[model samples]
Structure formats: structure tokens, C-alpha cells
Target: MKTMIVIPARLASSRLSEKLLLRAAGKSILQHTYEAAKRAAITDSIIVAADDPRIVAEVDSFGGEARLTSVDCQSGTDRLAEIALMHSDVDLFVNVQGDEPEISPATIDAVARLLATRPDADIATAAFPILDESKLHDPACVKVVMGANDRAILFSRASVPHVRDGITPAHLQASPPIFWQHIGLYAYRRDFLLWFATQPAGRLEQLEKLEQLRAIEAGKTIVVTAIESSPPGIDTLEDFREFVARIENQ
Candidate 1:
């Protein structure tokens, strides 16, 4: 199956404001993400599905391929749909969010591999065991409830599978793990993206502000690949600053 990586970059960001254009270690965040995606062994083809000419220009500056998508696209996956329409030859598309400059290439590979291996699955995503009690309660850290065979039952910002009695350190440190922090990285089949674009946003998706839930609510099978951990995405000025500090310190 032909696979490609698409980094959906919207120039306007609610938290950090044009954060993809923000530079760290002499590279724009979009470029950093693009380069990181390129490092993944899954596929060599990478495109930045940009919502603005500025983002296209930025990609051009890095000698990377980019296509201008409609600004009206609601989510990153929607932006990738636009690219999917253009590249019919590609069967699978991996979404590595432009904000995630520090995203792991292994995580990218894992998601792609999972989707490629599972014909029953419509989408494949990565998640890591959440060892921290604080992250379980923090809405910022999305939690995934897994059912069986690595299939995701649900994705929510709220703490789920509510320990009923209580959550203890043992629950957090369980062998199989009771809590998982969902990563934004995803590998979507071409047909899934096409069908997803035509469908209106699901109720659960809008309520949680998570695009993946739209598919979940629609009864699409989403498989999850367990990863060790994930690097932080740049969502705010503080996140960008911390990323810069880490890069500079490196």
C-alpha cells in the first residue's frame, strides 16, 4: 500500500498565534515537524497541507513540498482530506501535526505500521501509558479506553473507566496499564478520509473538541499502538519556550 505523510499547518493558532511559523534551533516549527516526519522509515513522501500561502512559502523555504488548503477546513484531518483528494495514488496518509516539532519518528512509524497491518482498522493512532496521577485528571492529557486487541473503545479529555472505588499508585503502575495518554499522531486510510470529509462532525467530537471522536462515534474501528512516551507539542507560548530551551540546551 502506498503511504505518505501530510503535515496540516494552519497559520492561525488559537493558543500561540501562527506558532507553526515560530522558529526553534534555526528552523520553523513546521519545518522541524516536516523534517522529523521525513526521518520516519514508513514512507519518504511528505507534504505540508497548509491553510495559507505563508505556510506554503515557509515549506518552500525548506525545499519541502506543500499544497494550499482551504482555511475553512475545521480540523487537521479535514486539511488532510483536501490533500487526499489531490493524491489519489496514495493509499495511506499519516498526520504528524505541524505543532509537534519534537514528535518521535518511532511513534510515526508505529502508527503507520499499525494501520498497514490491520485491515479491519480504519485508523491507527499512538498512545502511551499515563503513569502520572496528575495527567489522568488534567483535561489537556487525552485519555483512551482500550477494549481488546489494541482497539480503542473511546477517546476523551475526561478521566474515564473511572476506577469506581479510587485510583491508586498500583492502578497507575499496573502491568497492562489502566490509563493511556492519547497522542495526536495518526495513520488514516485514503477511503476513511474521503468518507470522513463528507460526514458532519459527530456530537461527541464537538463536545470533546477532538476530531478523532467523530470517527469513533461513527463506529469506525480505530486501533491504538502503545508507545513508551511522546514529546510535547507546541500549543502555547510556554510550550514553545520550553521546546526552544531543550533544543538550545542540546
Candidate 2:
């Protein structure tokens, strides 16, 4: 199957303004993410689906491929759906959030593999167990509850599978894990992308502000693959600082 990775980026970041364009270690964050996605062997190509000319120019500066999508596009998934229309031959499109410069190539490949191997699933994503009680409680940390055989039952900002009886924290870290943190990385079939773009947001989706719910409400099967951990993506000044430290230290 032909597979391609698309990185959606724009310059209108509210927090850590222009976070994708922010330079760290002499390279823009978008460039770093592009390079990281290129490391994956499963993808036939990597393209930045940018929304602005400045973003397109930045990709050009780094000698990376980029295509400008309409500014009207609402989300990263919409950007990928735009590309899906252009590449009808491509069977799968992986949405690598441009902010995820430290994203793991193995995790990227794992999500694609999950979709390819599971005939019941139309989409696939990655998640890792959250052992920290604070993280479990943090609304910023999205969680996924798995059903039988790696199928995701639901995704939420709340700490799910609530230990109603209040068991020790150790129980949360059980091999299967009671609390699994959802990762933003995703892989979608070409047909699924088309369908997703046309569907309106579901009630739960609007409430949680999680776009993935639109699929769940549509009765689409989504498979989740377990990964070691999520990559630290920049969202605020502090996040950028930590990313800078990692680069300089490396």
C-alpha cells in the first residue's frame, strides 16, 4: 500500500506565537518535525501541508517538500483531507502534527501498521500509559480507554476508567494499564479522510473539543497502538525552552 506522511502547519499559533516557525538550535520547529518524519521508512513521501506562504517559504528554506492548502481549512485532519484528494493512488495518509518535532518514527510506523493489519479499523492512533496521578488528573493530558483487541472505546480529557473505589496508584500502572494517555499522532485511510472532512462534529466532540470523537460517533472503528511515550511538542514558551534544551544538550 502506498503511504505518505503530511505535516499540517500554520503561523497563527496563539500560544508561543508562531511556535512552528520558532527557531531552536538554528532550525525552525516545523523544519525539525519535517526532518523527524523523513526518518520513517514506511512512508513513500513526507509533505508539509502549510496554510500560509511564510510556512511554505520556511519549508523551502529547509529543502523539504510543502504544499499550500486553503486558509479556510479548519484543522490538521482537514489539511490531510485536502492532500488526499490530490493523491488518489495513496492508500494511507499519516497526520504528523507539525509541532511534534520529537515524534518517534517507530510510533508513526506502528500506527500505520495497525490500520493495515486490522481490517475492522478505518483509522489508527498511538497512546501510552500514564502512571503519574497528576498527569491522570491533568485535563491537558488526553486519555484513551481501550476495548477488546486494541480498539479504542473512547478518548477524553478526563481521567477515564475511574477507580471509583480509589485503589492505590500502583494499580493504574498494571501491565494493561488503567490510564492510557492519548497521543496526537494518527494514521487514516484515504477513504476515511474523505468521510471525516464531510461529517459534522458530534455532540461529544464539541463538548470535549476532541476532533477524533466525530469518527467514534459515526461508528467508525479506530485501533490504538501502545507506544513508549509521547514526544514533547511545543505549545508554550516553557515547552519551547525545554525543546531548546534538548537540542542544545544533544
C-alpha RMSD (angstroms) for model 1: 0.9
Flag regions of model 2 displaced more than 4 Å: none
lDDT of 1 by residue, 129-192 (tens): 9998999899999999999899999999999879989999999999998899999889999999
lDDT of 1: 0.92
In angstroms, give how far residue 150 of model 2 lies from its true place.
Answer: 0.4
lDDT of 2 by residue, 1-250 (tens): 8999999998898887888989999999998899989999789999999999999999999899999998889999999999999999999999999999898888999999888888789999999988888887888999999999999899999879788878585786687788899989889999999999988999999999999999998899999999878878899999999999989999
C-alpha lDDT of residue 100 in model 2: 91
